[model samples]
Target: MSSKRMATIMGVTYGIAAIMPFFVGDIRFIMHILIMCLIWAVVASCWDLIMGFAGIFSFGQVAFFVIGAYTSAILSVQWNVPSVVAILLAGVFTAGMGVIVGLPCLKLAGPYVALVTFGVHMTLMPVLRGEIGIALGSGGSQGILTIPPVNILGYTFSSANQIPTFYFTLFLSVVCTVIILAVIKSYWGTAFLALKDSEEFAMSLGVSAFKYKLMVFALTSFLTGVMGAFYGHYIGMLSTRMLELDLFCTLMVMLVVGGIGRFPGAILGAFITVTANELLAPLGAYRAVTLGALVVLLVLLLPNGVMGLWLKRSDAEA
Candidate 1:
């Protein structure tokens, strides 16, 4: 997508979000959902950046997110660090973890890469509940409780100050969104598309697959980590429950519904999927089944997802 076009899309997506509080300000549940959508949109966009654009079949996004959340929670609770610094530190830590994992796994084939990444997600539960986790203030199996809200100067982004929290999250989301858009419009994005088109040919054209792929992967991990830390602070706790396949599948649904490789679509998908998940809440246990069915339907009927449909219409009109 052209820079101008993508910017317009982001503006609209975030524009709607900016105005959302005015209508639903009284409904705390809706406000909470909106905040979550903002949070997940960045994470989902990062996933799209890697898998959709860079063509890396990484299944470790949730792992990185959980890592970031725990890292921030531990930093503030155990070490007495400020929440702002803790969030950034958590991002850096997660990015380093991504590099550690990526340096080895990026050399593997697609499915193998997915397996290794997914392995990270799977093993995290035990690791957090073990001795090492306790040493780092992971709270072991009990998880980190009593996490303080993100405090800026004298202000706390607690639920008690919902308006400020909403705007605060939105501000972070905007920064991440602009960064994602900027990456896609820059040489890095061009290189990623080249690598995706044909890694061998792109490599022959002097694109270093290892160099570009690993860098973008780390960048995505960093963003996901930051948002994850925000979530931990906002919720006031951290737990291994985040690693469940159910959450993983839900993240996948965001990408699939948005149209993998589709930039703003992932953003839109996050909003739609988060809201839909809430609607499906009444279904209780059947929610997962319903989401699975929805995915299958989107795959078979609209393989490109909602973005694909929009693109098809645009093409026809043109």
Candidate 2:
């Protein structure tokens, strides 16, 4: 797809999100969902950039997110740093972790990379719940319970200011989306495509496979980290529960339903999955089952995900 076409979809999505609070501003529940949709959209888009476009099979997105959340929460709640500064610092911390993990892991085969990254996810829970995390003000099992809301200048964004929070999140999401799109159209993106086609060949053509992968990995980690901090501040809490399989699986469902490698599809998928998952709340315990069955049906019916419905074979994934 043309860059313009790719951007149009996101533009339209953002346009819809921009006006959502006008209609549902007073409905806290719906407003909360909208806020989550924006948050998840950017996070999912970052996942798409990694697993979909860059073809990195890392499962550490959740870990990176929780890392960011806890990092910011500890900085603000325990150390007295400003919420805004903490969030950016959280991104930097996660990106550093990404580099550390990616350094050796990226040299391995695809499945091995997945295992190593997922291993990071698996180990994070213990690290957070154990003595080490508590020393860093993690709150251990109790989790951080008193994270302050994001305060910009004199204005505060929190549950009390749902509409303002939504727009603020929208602004952040838009910035992240623009960066993702730019990366997709840049040489970094083209480098990934070449590497995907054949890393050996791409390397011969002067593309640094490991470098490009690491760069994108760090970039996505940074974005996910920022959003994670945003989520923590918005919710006024942080917990290890985010590491559970349910949220991880929901992220996978977003990519699966949105079509792996599809740019704007990630955005669409996050909205659809989050909203649908909520709508199924009345089913009680059957919600996960229904979601599983829905994913299976969608995979069988729409192999390319929802984006496949619109993009042609010759079209670019982004």
Report lDDT per candidate: 0.90, 0.91
Q: Which residue pairs overlap in candidate 2's backbone? A: 1-316
Error of 1 at 178 (Å): 1.2
Runs off by more than 4 Å, candidate 2? 316-318
Taking the tens digit of each residue's C-alpha lDDT, what string does model 1 give over 1-318? 567777887898899999998999989999999999999999999999989888888999999999999999999999889999999999999999998889877689889989999999999999999998888789998899899999999889987778889999999999998899889888999999899888899999999999998898799999999999999999999899999887898899999888888787899889988999999999999998897788888878877777775564653232
Off by over 4 Å in 1: 312-318
Q: 8, model 1: CA deviation in Å?
A: 1.6
Give lDDT tens digits, candidate 2, residues 147-220: 99999998999988899899999999999989999999999989977887788889999999879989988999
> Clash pairs of candidate 1?
none
Query: What are the TM-scores, per candidate, against the unseen true structure?
Result: 0.96, 0.98
Which candidate leads in lDDT?
A: 2
- Give per-residue lDDT, candidate 2, residue 162: 93
